[model samples]
Target: MSSGALTAFILRSPVFAGLLCFFVCAGPCPGREDDQARVLYARAQKLLSEGDPDEALDRYLTLLKKHPRTEWSALSLWDMYRIYIHQDSPEPAFEVLNRLIVEQPGHFEKAHAAQLQLVQRILGSGKEARTNLESVKKKKPLPPEIVVEMLKTVIKNGPHSEVGIQAHYYLAIAREQAGEKTEAIAAHEDFAETYSSHELADDAGYQSAYIAYKSWKSMRSTGPHQRENAAVALAWFIARFPESDKAAQARSCLAEVRAAELSELLGLARYYEARSNPKAALIYYQQIASRFPEVIQTDEVLRDKILSLKGAEEVVGPVR
Candidate 1:
């Protein structure tokens, strides 16, 4: 139809005019899509302001379907995510947020801000969560899965924020509580590496080393290799956090590991001595005297033992 005839038809039949506008104005109006999207977006926001989130969600979804490539669609998706979060449905919120992030990379900060808000809503204020964590020493006292999801969200969305740092710290605790020592250590390490300037960085490092130390210490038959790893971890903790409150404990742990190593060496020396292999026994005794003199039960006793072993080996012709 000619523009004039269409205008006349629109002017003559209001119902038809309304139907025409619904289909034409609401559909893809190439050059006018931006204006149309703005109008639709305003309507959705109005619905939301009027406490009709269900209707607002419908309008936002319709806006997306009609103007999928328009900038307004990205805005609509973000609003939809907010709606889902308000409705306590994180699954859809995450879905919409993922789409918004991918479709509008420049809007990543907006999406990240929105995700942080959602996480805060889910987990409450950071101070409150921290207080609860400090008070509760039980394993998985908070919902592990939900806390884990929040941690992932913050780490992925706002890794440099205070919330992200806190999430990383709490995730380590949660993983440890859940008996995931390896994952806990990794999380603590990641936090320490990524946020070295953060106040909790030293604590994160300590937790990582302490977890490894505890695992090895609790073993029924701790081998030299395990002892070595645990000692290295404790030593790292001591070096990294010399002034930290945990430093003393770390030193003590290091001392215990060294003592264990020395004990193992002495046991080996005694075993070889029982077998009448003075040369082999002497090697072990010398290892204790030279490599672990500090851990020897007594300096004089270790020296005497080393000398006795050496004399016995010489008498046996060095076991050759």
Candidate 2:
């Protein structure tokens, strides 16, 4: 049982000698580091499949750091990217994805395309977030705070990039959907200003005006200030986008606002006339006739009213 006897015995047997040669030539046993990495990768995948993504993410990160050159490293990075996306942390997800694309283009091409498709879907360039809509209806939509964070990331990091433009557009839609009219208008305006040459610029401009008009309509009481704001928005839209598809609608809204102003002036004139203030009533009627001549027959009626008021004042000797 001495070492020399054992070696001799092994060398004397053809089968044992062949097995030893094969083992030596095939290379040393797989390293402990590789074994550890494999075990960790399997555990991470299991944790993810069991709905423990946070733990899975930690495990994957550990594997990547400890076994960077191992075969599992690329796969671990990809899985981590998926988890980040599922958590709505697109910034980190993008980081991981870019790394994967740089390190293993052939392996990650499909994943990169999938990520782009997801972004397009959320931005309504695709089927309008089918999964997201379902999640919303089920009361399980991704956290709004997280979405906001992701949007901010896209805007800040890729402002002039294609994804950034889409992100801006999507942010405006999100604000509108949440009933944040002022915020929506601001976002739309920002997109239009920042990406003037983009195809969506005209649409953004139109949406800004439309949102302003809608806000004006939803008010219980319309005043000069409200009318002025709405009128300005419509006028901007009309002048800036006369050739736009929404131009007709913008012009109609403008006319409605102008008519409301004319009606208001007419009401004031009538009220002054009823109160025996002929001079004041005449001023109002004349103002309307001069300012709104395009109001159809109303211009002639306003002029006639002005003349009658002046006549009444002259006959009454300007009653105070």
Candidate 3:
């Protein structure tokens, strides 16, 4: 048999398997043993080339057990790591690489570089979410909700570099687009609250207010809603940077939310008016006009109130 194949057969034997872990040999061997190891390695390469990863993995494991301190041991382990990673088995890759790092602290730089690459694969690649976010435009494409979770991983594990901040910002945007309003709101809150000095803070603030308003609108029917909360958040956005370009947008958002609130009260007032309860309607109209006089609806409420008073006077047959 060839040297590589002979190694594979020898290592498969029970006696060799048991002795392999601690076996130490020096120099190019005379015959059988040298032939055996070469044969094993060659067989493994063949399996790997043929896409028989399972068999390839088993052979590598056997090679490691037999020659844990061999010069090529790290190479074998790294190959196994690559195969597992290629299979999308990050957990196993993580486990193996983690062990390798622990056992070989000298490999720290290599391990960390590998981690960076892996993070890109698992988080930014969008493979897990099954999306082509890289090639897709924001307006033309929809973000899958999974992007949020992926961003979280990147933010947690990636270095605290520009890439990290970018990850956080993208995550916030992705969450916003996925209609995960609460998470999106919280993410922006986190960004705006903690990363106020970040270069992207202004953009984040504008997007936060937009998301807050959208979230508030969607959750309006829920008791103790967030419309007012959204206004408060907008106020913070404006107060933090009054000169910011986004400040005008934040102000507009605040105005729109107040207008919505006033509109709601106006609707309620009309409901009561239709039911012939002018007193309750007046209360609602007055509340809207008094509390939110700047809203356009305030003028509409005042007109309704004036007409209601005139109708009441006519119904009572002319007050003196």
Candidate 4:
């Protein structure tokens, strides 16, 4: 239709006339360009409602370029991302939503939800990265090397997001499980220290203590008593958060270490006794009884200390 004929048809259409009258002035317009953008945007919404996303997206993009702040541009972009998600193209959806998070933090919840949906979909599909991971698992148990590599990927890509701590924690656990005790201890320590103020601080602290205790226990024969190390780690947790709910746990762990130390002293006493060194055995037993009087084995240790001292005194014929 000719422009004049089309105008006449639009004037005859109640919907078109209503929109024009509501949005456009009857007099000469100084901001006619902006009004034209609004008209296009309204038409895009209409097309989207009518199930014409292709055309709707085209017009929305045009409107955005023409008048980026038409008050509906953010919504337009959000809609585009939603459409991408519905189409099962989550990569682009996540990208757009992530950009929205950075560009408009007030809308971060919406963007974060969208991104989480995309990640879940990707994981649920059992494809891409997830597929490869599943496939590898089917072939053989994941080696320490592979687990570490996977964790590193999450850490490197997820720093600005909440995924960093998760990745690091997983890697640390994987390392510990794979018998890489030293590396696991280091990883847990770093994660707990670096993200102390993060949302995952408590979780990190719990895991750090748990992992360090286990790793140190397993590696004790190499020197530096493992129970002592575990005690030190528990102390760190307790000192850092004195009133934490985990304080009870830390106290229990400290008690275990104290008991272990007493056990070590008793073991040394037994060794001296076996070697027929009554004086040394007596001294070690007395040390355990005196220093660890609150230990669970305190009563037995005190009786042993008395017997050892009496035996040593008889062997030495009453020392002055």
Using lDDT, give the best candidate's number: 1
The TM-score leader among the candidates is: 2
Write down the lDDT that model 3 would get.
Answer: 0.67
- Write down the lDDT of every candidate, Cα atoms only: 0.76, 0.75, 0.67, 0.66
Candidate 4 residue spans exceeding 4 A from truth? 1-141, 216-224, 274-276, 289-320
Task: Provide TM-scores for the models.
Answer: 0.58, 0.65, 0.53, 0.48
Instruction: Give a tens-digit lDDT track for model 1, residues 29-86.
Output: 6779888889999999999888788999899989988888888998899778766655
Instruction: Please identify model 3 stretches exceeding 4 Å from their true place.
Output: 1-44, 62-78, 96-188, 199-224, 238-259, 276-279, 296-320
What is the per-residue lDDT of model 3 for residues 1-93, given as tens digits with 9 covering 90 to 100? 999999999888888877775466445454655456567777888998886878988987887777655534566667777777666666566
Ranking by TM-score: 2, 1, 3, 4
lDDT sort, best first: 1, 2, 3, 4
lDDT of 4 by residue, 190-248 (tens): 77788777655555566667666665556646333666677777878777767667778
Summed backbone clashes in each candidate are 0, 0, 9, 0
Superposed Cα deviation of residue 274, candidate 1 (Å): 3.7
